[model samples]
Target: MDTDAYTTMRFERRGQILTVFFRDPAEANTSDLAIHEEVGRLFHDLREEREARAIVLTGSGPAFFTGLKDPVGSLLWQREQGLPVIDAGRQVARRIVWDLLDVEIPLVAALNGDATGLGATIALFCDAIFMADTATVADPHVRIGVVAGDGGAAIWPMVMGPALAKRYLLTGDPVTASEAAHLGLVTHVCPVGEVLPAATAFARRLAAGAPLAVRYTKMAVNRLLKDTMAGAIEQGLAHELLTFTSEDMVEALTAARDGRTPAFHGR
Candidate 1:
C-alpha cells in the first residue's frame, strides 16, 4: 500500500505487521470529517493489502483518540452553509463501520491514552485491545448533545452487554482501563508506556499463526458485530444528525464555549 498517500495517519511496516499511528498529536489525535473519511478509506485499502498479515493501531500522543474536532462548530457551520449534514453523516458513518469490519487481517488496538466517543468505538471494534493503565475510554457523544452513533451504540453493547453499555453511554462517563478490562471491553491492560509494545507483540504472534485460520476465525466472530451494526448504525447516525439541529445542541455548544455545564431541555 502507498503509505505516503495518507496524511492524517502514518504507517510503518515491519515484516508482515503493519503499525498505523494516528497523527495530529498536537490535537490529541482528534478526528474531523477529513480524518474520519481518511480512516474509512484506509481500512478499505488495508483489505486489499495482502502483505500485511496483522495490523496494530495506536495514537502518536497522550490520547489514543479524542473523537471529533470541534463537532459542534462543524455542525453549526454546516447548518449555516445549508449543507446536508444528515446525508453526509450517513455516508461517512456507514463507510467507517463497514470498511473496518471488512478487513480480514487481525487488527489490534494499542490504547496509549484516552479513547472517547468515536475513538472508543474504533478501539473496541478491534480483534484485541491493549489499553494503558492510565488511559480511559468512553463513548460520550451525549455529553456534547449527540447520540452514541458511529458504531458506538452497536459495538459497545456487543463488547460489554447492553446493561453496562447503557450505563456509560447514557451518562457519557469515562471508564478506567481496569474497569474496561473487567467489563471485557479490553483484552489486556498494561502500565503506561507499555501498551504499544504489548499490542505489537500480540499482533506479531497472531501474524505467525496460520493466516487463513486466524482470518477466518475473526471473520466468523465478526458476523455478530456486522449484523448488529446493520440493524443499529443507520438509525443511530440518523438520530445523531437530527440532534445536531436541536435547540439542546445549540445550548450544549454554547455552554461548552462558556466553560459551563450544559442545561439540556431535550428539545
Candidate 2:
C-alpha cells in the first residue's frame, strides 16, 4: 500500500491497472478533508497515465468505504473558517465519481467488505462492482442523522428500483449480498476470498479489449447515468448543504455523539 500525507487513501499501479484503496481502519474507512483531496488527485493522476487501462478501488481494513460522518460539522467547519461551505466533501466526492464515470479507462469496485454512505457511493460510481459474499452495502445517511445525499440520492434509484431505493435510502438500512445481486446492484458477487481476484480478472479482460471501443462504449453508458442523475444529485446536494446550519442537524449530531436516537423537530 502506497501512503501519502495528502491522501489518506492508497494507490498501487500494476501493469495497466491502478488500484486505489480507502485505508482508514477506525470509523470504518471514513474520509476526512485530506482524504477527499487525495482521491481527487489520485483520479487526476490516473487520468494522465497512458498505460492505465483500468482502475479498481476497495478498502484496506473492513470496508470499501464507510461514507462521510460529520455532514453538518464538516460543512460548518468551512464556514467557521470563513470559506464557502457548499458541500465541500460532497462536491469533491461527486467530482471523484464523475471522474470514474467520465474517464476513458474502465472502473471497477472490489467490495471486499461493508460499504456505507460515501463508501457506497464510490462503489456505485464504478462501471462495474464486484462484491464479496460477506460484504454489505448501505447508505445509512438518514438513520445516522442526515440527509441521504452524497451519491446515494443520485445513483441508488438508477441501479435498484424506486421502491427498494426508497426503503434503503430512507431507512438507512443495508442490502445483503444476495439481495444486492438479485436487484442488480452489483455486477458480480463472489465468495469472500474471490472478490479481489474476480475483479482483477474481470478488469484484465477489459484491459485487453479494444481500448478505444471499450472506452467509447463505457462513455456512452455513463452519459446515460449522467443525464438521469445530474439533476437529482444537484438538488439533494443543495439540501444537504443547507442542513449544515439547520437545527435538526445540530440535534442529530448531538444525539449521535451522546449515543442516543435523535428526535428531529424538522427545523
Candidate 3:
C-alpha cells in the first residue's frame, strides 16, 4: 500500500497486518478538523488493500489522541469567518464517524495514552481495544456544551450498557484503564510498552485466520452498532450543532480561554 498518500495518518504494512499510526512524527494525534477529514476516507481506502487481512489502529506519540485541537478556537474562528458551524460540525461528528463504522475489516486499537472526546469514540469503534496500563478514556462533549454526537451516543451504550454510559456521558468524567477493563469496555490493559506488541500479535492472528469467516463474523456482529448509529447520529449531530449557537456554548468557550468557571444561564 502507498502509505505516503495519507498526510494526517501514517500507514505501514507488514505481511497481512496493516498498521495505521494516527499521525506523523512531528505532531501528536489530535482529532482536529484536518484529521476528521482524513479518518472519514481512510477506512474506505483500506477496504481495497487486498493484502491487509487485519488492521491495527494506533496513535504515535505520548498521547494516544485528544479532542479537537482547540474546540473554542475552531468554533470562534468559524463564527468570525462567517462559516457555517452546523455544516462543519456535523461533517466531523456525524459523517466521519458514520463512515468509520462501515469498515468491514477487523480493527485493533492500541491506546498508548490518553483518549478523550472523539478520540475515545474512535477507540470504542474498533473491534478490539487494548489500552496502555496508564491510559485513560473520556468523552467530554458535555463539558464544552456540545452533545456527544461523534459516535459516543451510538457506541458507548453497546460497550458499557446504557446506565453506565449515561453516567459517564452526563458527567464527562475520565475512565482510567483499570476502570475501563473492570467495566468490560476494553479488551485488555497492558503496560504502555506492551500495548502495541499485544495488539500486533492479535492482528496477525486474525490476519492468518480464515478470511471469509473473520470478515463475515465481524459484519454480523456490527449490525447492531450500525443500526444504533443510523437511528441516533443524525438527530444527535443536529442537536449538538444547535447547542453550538447557544449562549452557554459561548460562555463555556470564553471561560475555557480565560481560565474561569462558566456560570451558565441555561439558554
Output the lDDT of residue 100, model 1.
86
Candidate 2 regions with alpha-carbon error over 4 angstroms: 1-6, 25-31, 67-83
Candidate with top TM-score is: 1
Q: Candidate 1 overall Cα lDDT vs. reference?
A: 0.85
Using TM-score as the yardstick, the better of models 1 and 3 is: 1
Candidate 2 on 202-267: residue-level lDDT in tens?
Answer: 888889999999999988998999899988887877776666556676677667778887888877
Off by over 4 Å in 1: 25-31
Q: What are the runs in model 3 whose C-alpha is more than 4 Å off?
A: 24-31, 81-85
List pairs with backbone clashes in candidate 3.
none
lDDT head-to-head 1 vs 3, winner = 1
In what order do the candidates fall by lDDT, top score first? Answer: 1, 3, 2
lDDT of 3 by residue, 1-267 (tens): 466767777878898889988763336354456666666667667666677888998888776777456678877665565437557767756656755666777889999988888789889988999999999999888887778877787788888889999999988999999999999889999999999999999999998889999988898877777876677777777777777777787888899999999888888
Clash count for candidate 3 is 0
Q: How much lDDT does each candidate structure score?
A: 0.85, 0.77, 0.80
Using lDDT as the yardstick, the better of models 1 and 2 is: 1
